[model samples]
Target: MPFGKVPVLEIDGKVLNQSTAITRYLSKKAGLAGSDDWESLLIDIAVDNIHDLRQEIASYFYDPNEVTREAKYAPLINETIPFYMDKFEKTVEENNGYFVNGKLSWADLFFVAILSYLNSSVKIDLLEGRPKLRALKEQVLAVPQIKAWVAKRPTDIP
Candidate 1:
């Protein structure tokens, strides 16, 4: 708990903080990180953008006052969501349904992870206007492991 965070991973007796770093480490170990450096770079970019979107949603979650939350939600729904969703839609379209290189990578998994949180927190369908994003979600969900996990995952939101 170097940062007092829950996602700290203990791998080989080495503690790793930061969810993204832990994910990259484990994904690489599982051969789901990326095939090569360039693919990894692409995945990095996509993951960063996805995190940016998540941050916007997190702002809404952490606001203590209704006035502040409502104020934040407007710009989030109007500007931030649209901007990132459009970019992600384009990236998914260019990457052949996957988030990168037409293959399943950590980037796709990251999006799927955040997608659920975003879905439960918001009233609107975040991917309503983004067909490619919808397809990307479907593609990620189709993975047998992910499908099984989600079927039993808790319905809690944060």
Candidate 2:
């Protein structure tokens, strides 16, 4: 009943119940998706991946089944993290050592979030030997605005 109904894009009369679609549209309109198609795709991938992983993590936290808990997080602790480390390293190296589009992009932000997850949740050195990954994390955090935001993010967003 807020807004007296669903929020509508009155300019063209588009209606969406979901927040993701609306944000994507606003992103395009605001020039934040970037100047080119690859850049926009990179942004989409990063945003979608964030949604995917965070959902899994939420389930990991709330799953009442022990088997489900182990299954949900074991791959996170053992496999997926290492996979991301290797994959992101190679992607950075092959893409001239930039996260996306030969420059820092939302993909890097995803990397940072993943790193933060690992740092906050895992005791193991999941990022060990991944200097490039380390550098990438540092690079993203070195941005003053992002640094402040990271500081503001909760330790347990699970």
Candidate 3:
């Protein structure tokens, strides 16, 4: 609870925090993680990048000043989002619609998680000019289990 975060997990009497770590652990448990060290490393890289992107978005959300928020929004719309999203789209395309090595790693799941938050919280269609990312989003959300989870979740953004 250092940052008062809610992703704190209790596994086998051991406590763990941080979303990325928790996700990684669960992904491995569910057989959704990478198949080898190299692939796992790639997944880590992708997850870290997503974390930074989410932080940038969070900074804008937490800013109380309209002028500052607007200033940040412009770059996010025209630069930051495109830069990250474009790279993500390319990676997904190269990996056959997945984030890592043509397989379903935690990277793909993290992409969807952050993508959904960005869509709802920022209310921006970040996927507008990115066809691959759009397709990836559709693919991720179409998973039977993910679809069921989304359907039962609250409608509110936050």
The regions of model 2 sitting more than 4 angstroms off are: 1-32, 49-59, 71-73, 148-158
TM-scores across all candidates? 0.88, 0.62, 0.88
Candidate 1 segments whose C-alpha is farther than 4 A from its true place: 154-158
lDDT of 1 by residue, 1-158 (tens): 78787888886798779878889988999898778888889889889888888878988977899998988888888898899899889888988898889888999888987786787776778889889989888988889998898788887633
Clashing pairs in 1: none
Model 2 vs. true fold: TM = 0.62
lDDT of each: 0.85, 0.65, 0.83
Stretches off by above 4 angstroms in model 3 are 1-4
Error of 2 at 9 (Å): 14
Ranking by TM-score: 1, 3, 2
Better of 1 and 2 by TM-score: 1
For model 2, what is the error of residue 140's alpha carbon versus the real structure, in angstroms, after optimal superposition?
Answer: 0.9
List model 2 lDDT by residue over 38-63, tens digit each. Answer: 78887777667556655655666668
On residues 11-57, what C-alpha lDDT tens digit does candidate 3 reach at each position? Answer: 78877788777888899998787888888899999888888888889
Question: Could you tell me the lDDT of residue 12 within candidate 2?
Answer: 52
